[model samples]
Target chain A: MYEFLTGPMVWISFGIFFIGLIVRGVRYIRGLDWKLDRVTYGENISYGVRGAVRSILFWLFPYGTRSWRKNPWFTLWVFLMHFGILITPIFLLGHNILLKEKLGISLWTLPEAVADTMTVVVIVSVVFLILRRIALPEVRIITNWYDYVLLLIAVSPFLTGFLAYHRVADYYFWLMAHIISGHVLLIAVPLTKLSHFLLFFMTRAQLGMDYGIKRGGMKSKGMAW
Target chain B: MPEGTLCNKKTIDTKEQLQALLADKSGKEYYEQMNDLDVDRKALWGVIQKSLKSRTKTWLEICSHCGLCAESCFYYLANNRDPKQVPSYKIQETLGKLIARKADVDNAFMQKCMDWAYSKCTCCTRCGVYCPFGIDTGIMFSYLRGLLYGQGFVPWEMKIGSGMHRIFRAQMDITTEDWVDTCEWMAEEYEEDWPGLEIPVDKENADIIYTVNAREPKHYPEDIAEAAILFHVAGENWTVPSEGWEETSLAMFAGDWEAAKMQVESVYDAMDRLKPERMVVTECGHAYRATVIEGPYWAGLKTGKTPIDSLHYVEWVAEALRTGKLKIDPSKKIKEPVTYQDSCNYIRNGGLADVAREIMSYIAEDFREMTPNREHNFCCGGGGGLNGIGRYREQRNIGMKVKRDQILGTGAKLVIAPCHNCWDAIRDLEEVYKIGIRWSFLKPLLINMLEVPEHLKPKEE
Candidate 1:
């Protein structure tokens, strides 16, 4: 009975998610008269490759020795948590199973322990993010309806997953709820502001390389072979 | 090899001089200079109000304010950690108020919001990066400034700055004759550095047409000389248009988008007339960014085609170095601790700080880093025409405290600023705060440090 209910819920959510995303995506695509095209246009391949690699590195261990040394505490925390949990674990990894599980195909067993701990980290990080957004007067001043929606979006799956892990409801129902919510998030990724996952790394690397050259800091050592 | 000492003689020292300087210069008796541009205040304000009206709905509709923007802002972290000076707050003080009043409150309050908005922000769009919404307040502010500009209520400094821009499409009110004479002076100076290296003016069909801000000729002549030397070494064919070569657009800074658009048109006009394959913008960050990126989209409605892929001088030089067209001796830059100030227009707005650093490393031996770098770098308080308006004095200084701390924190003996406004404003802070740090353009440092080969060097007497 739980499986039946779960199955249709998944299908319904997927349908709504796909349709909503397609509407938004098509709107954005059609909206490109010229200016949008200009921004989208660039040295696409160089930017695309650079963007993918650093984004993955950035999400994992964000405060990894270098960033923490460079940034202020709050900034580092916000940077790591926002990118690490909300963005990386959920948004970038695409329900955490798409890329991570695929890439770790041989090491699938390793993810169980990592996954449970990461789920906890996501909840804690989201809590920090929520409190920081509310606590900081500057952040609060700029917060809008979308921000609240995003914050809820980031927190819900983790909470549902945690509940599922603990079997808060009948085991299958909770897992089904988690799976449905997770997939909906996957469909929403490219259409919403969540797409920064796709955009930020390229912007940062381009910025990093551009600044590096302009200030005469270092040439593109062309990355380690 | 820091070139210019931060002139210790502060411009407006006492409160009295500050008052005199800030006072309406035109109001002085017998001091009638130019005809007052009897700008229509009400109609202009209406345009501004209309612009605000359009933006308010969007402003309220966007900006999640994740505080990633704060990390991206140099101003926030610089001023003893004051969050209000964050790019968003600088935006909010004006646009936020307008949004609240226009949608929720009253028109009179909206009028007050317009005043606050016009006076406070510089419209440098560095914070657009951290904005998950990509709500470019710079665009919003620039739009508002354009509206305010149409009305005579634009801050006085921007009025003069944009007025100059209107006249010459440059920062200063220079003429064709002055530009020729200035280039001649640079050519003659470069002769000492690279003899017979002529900075061709209005030379048609040159492969590259290098455009410079009027500031290089008007205030810092050496900057022009540095460019000439670089061109000489690179062996690239480049020319400057005698009439429309200037690329710095204060109108862009001041929010006079029409005037800003006109400036872009003039550069494109120069390109059309000169028919250069490409244009290498001089070492002015905003000027370069404006000519290539923002100027096009913000004003591209007027121009039929996207202008050629104009590159920043830093990018050009780094490429030249990479291609071995231009060579440098790293030891030429003294071993003294030196830090680079990323102009917000370039780093945040243009996303070119890494290129700037790449260029600097080849010249300097010891380099110190600014705390928040690249896209996350702070504004030098001079961006967005803040320095242009004399009325914004105290606020500009307070805002500059962020940059002041960044430079001071580096404890570097020298700071390299690529943009003219950053150069002027940061130099002002060094003097005002008595931070005792010397500053110069990146090229000047390179020129001083680099060993121009005897054959490349100008022939000795």
Candidate 2:
């Protein structure tokens, strides 16, 4: 059962992830009508690209914006959540070894101890994120069963992986749970709010261009300082 | 990625549809009828389908409700950090739910949505600056207001305001004749000081076509005089169109897109009729936004640019000062402890924050900026037609506390508000909170400190 779960299920999940991503991305750009979305009219691609680069760069760091600086705790946790969720899955020694065996290709891998610590970090970040949803009144007001389920789905792999590594429960059983949850996460990325992972770049770029071409105007040469 | 009005060219002209949905009643009867109005569920869902484009769908779908946008909203801050006032939750309660459920909604729910969209938010767009994903609640509320107007669920004053635009091509009942006559009267009044000064009407192929808010003719004729004085002293060839002089659009404020289109079209028509080199609007925030930015989209202009290049009053003034056309007397520059009120439409939405600051250097000697000045400044709490709506007056006053605190922190005795809406809001803030600070528009301040050109100056008077 474990062999089947680890072998074929991984391939299926990866296939869905890649296919869903391309389809959603293509549809998004194609769906943007020049007439309805006013951004098309005044959008100078050179200026838009410049603006998008600047905005994304600024938002990538802690305390980059006044809004970010205003909420330091949220900033710290969000970065940690993203770090562990992304880094642990991609760079773990076990995952890399598995990838090498499957495809006869190997990349650099994180040290075993560091990778394990990151898995624990993902679990901690998830706890804080879940607490925020339950405790913060503004967050609570907009949150629903959908939000909780997404959070739960996102954190399960990290939690189960950590448990399996620490030998807290039956190792083989927990390892199976980790692999299944990890597969579910991969499939869920393009289907659910987790799409924010990629949509962030798209929306943030659109926002920057909207501000630059449509409103902010970027102190361009034409503007008489 | 999404559906929209684009598939059907026939659906593009939505002005008549909006006009038809506008309720005629006002005051008591207006409120009563609005209370009992039935939700057009089919049509509402139809709008929901159209609004679910790439931008709308993505914004609604991916807003993770992090609560980081809570402090970014003045409504949340001023309401003592009420979670309900958070920008994310406010948009979610109305537009988000509308999209999620495909508007399986009722009249009571629609009424609650209307209250939140109109009263709770001013469509200031400041929250967009703070949003991690740049999901502007202002944009969502604006779209929601459009839906609410279709359902006959708009506020009383907003309905009346849109009606005025329909009848008079102005927010008030001031007609073209009144606007032209007021310009003439101002020209006559200022002629004694600057000989042969004329408010040129319909002079084709000149430099600029100066347009103004309707309220300038109805309440403050001096604003007309002040603008004419600036142009006359600068020796620019300018004309004011008799038919389409009113530049403000209460229709845009009321979500009456049809009437709003008509309002801006009149201004566009004036520019087209005169064939001027450019258009220069008076110091009104939303008016500039309506005519220069959003209005073109409604009018179906493919370029998203106005018929001609348009400058905000502040931009023009800054250019005039920079080019040595209109000089400010250094001696007469204001010596008071003054601060500039950054109107959201002009500063945050219009990208004239630096231009406004440059203008301040010429006029104000001791300029103290608001704590979070320029694009990040808080709304003065009366934008988005909130000041006019009687039902939201209390909430409007409550919302002023943020601006009030910001002003107090600045320690500036005089607040220089460039936009008409911001100017009106500052005045109201003083009246309500007794902030003990005086407010003045840029025109009166500039006219007072301006050095009358040697040639235009009356001889030996």
Query: Which candidate gets the maximum DockQ versus the true structure?
Result: 2
Most accurate candidate by TM-score: 2
Worst lDDT 10-window in candidate 1 chain B: B1-10
lDDT scores in order: 0.61, 0.81
Off by over 4 Å in 1: A1-18, A36-134, A140-225, B1-65, B86-126, B131-140, B147-153, B185-197, B233-236, B298-309, B319-332, B348-351, B450-461
TM-score result, candidate 1 = 0.69
Native contact recovery (fnat) for each candidate is: 0.15, 0.52
Q: Model 1, B329-379: lDDT tens per residue?
A: 765656889898887666655556668878876777778898866655677
For every model in order, what is the iRMS? 8.0, 3.9
How accurate locally is residue B212 in candidate 1, as Cα lDDT from 0 to 100?
Answer: 87
TM-score of each: 0.69, 0.94
Local accuracy of candidate 2 as per-residue lDDT tens digits, A26-118: 877766655555564245677667667766767877778778888899889888888889888888888888889888787789999998888
Clashes in model 2: which pairs? none
